[model samples]
Target: MRAARFRPGACLVLALVAVLAGGTQQASAETSPNLAIDAPPSAVVMTAPLDPSPGTLLTFSVAVTPGTNPTSTGLYVNCDLSWLGLGPSAPLFDDGTNGDPTAGDLTFTVQATIPSGTKPGTRLGDCGVFDAESRSASTSYSVNVVPAATDVGPSVTDTVPLSDATDVATDANVTITFSEAVDATGSWYALSCASSGDHTASVTGGPQSYLLDPGTDFAAGELCTVTVTA
Candidate 1:
């Protein structure tokens, strides 16, 4: 009791220690809950319209869910239409988090242009999505390419002047009009030049006009001949 009468400093030290202990307890009680993701680990779903038409644009939708809502996440989808062996394969599309949890579904769309002259059969390929962090939970879908009506024909309507004076451009391009859409793979089209040069060509068009690009250009004032085989 005699020591306490002169122990103001000791009392002050005890009060500070009690205040710090109370603050630490309150901070621990206010902590946030842990984040979580609940998507299927190895599942995916995709859908498209029935009886899709050739050369017509089609939309494909894909859905993906992640096993855990990662602090950092992204979605990627790759499609191969080469089974159709059309032109080039379809490009990949990305579907990131749409301000939603990582465990929810994401949708993606693409336009399908049936090859200019695709055969009547089923086109097959695969589609898949993966997370940057947890790739083990990736999902994939089998893509099917269905046959559509074929009404393309071969008929040349007109030709326009080309602008290759030097005639050195290997890929000189020109325009050709058509009476109707022609089958690009059909045996009714031929592109040639009169100069007897080592030149190759490809034809690309829709319902109205075809763009032709020669692997090599013709001599000055030399005429290039294009034949359509339908």
Candidate 2:
């Protein structure tokens, strides 16, 4: 069958995919307050460091609203993020502990580790916000885990216009390859010739390789030197 073009029906699916890729998902259950004994949470909140890496800590919290359950007090919270190796049904607290900001505010919070060796990805899951009794409310949550940044400094692996060369092209651009990805912020290069004096070049390109495009060419038969600082 031929592929379908942009249709209204595809919008919902695309939007859902976009959310799953880089957004949070949440849903709340509807229950008649007067008929229930346990208060259901109106919202669940999960927080972590920006682009958290494996082994980082994550916090989960839920806000409970009073229902017709007049006797409900001392609310409890538990979350299942076992996909991250944290035990299922891990407890959260509202007693101004375990990262909770206030006690008896109906907002319970807890922290859990992402665990070492956890691959980077967006993980979707849920938590249970319960009253003092057996009744509980469910809320879905997600975490976006990113790969850890490498700590090893970059080293030059190779370069164009090889170390020392005879009769070289004056307008040639210098290219360099690095052992690892590099940050080019505040990077610069200087090219000078024995006969032509100091020269200037625009440093460009990226994490693994860079190119140096000189504004002026080297003088013929002149010894040239290049300096790079990144």
Best by TM-score: 2
lDDT of 2 by residue, 121-198 (tens): 988778776665455677788878899777776678888888787778988888888898877656456678898888
Task: lDDT for model 1, please.
Answer: 0.56
Model 1 Cα displacement at 51 (Å)?
1.9
Looking at candidate 1, the ten consecutive residues that score lowest on lDDT are 95-104
Please report, in order, the local distance difference test score of every candidate based on alpha carbons: 0.56, 0.75
- Candidate closest to the true structure, highest lDDT: 2
lDDT of 1 by residue, 1-230 (tens): 36545688998999999999999988998896776755533435454555565665555555555446443266555455564443333444433332222333455445555565755555545665666765644334444445665556556667654333344443457677767765455544566666664455676775578676776666665655656554
TM-score, every prediction: 0.36, 0.47
**lDDT for position 230 in model 1:** 48
Q: What lDDT is obtained when candidate 2 is compared to the true structure?
A: 0.75
Candidate 1, residue 50: how far the Cα is off, in Å: 1.1
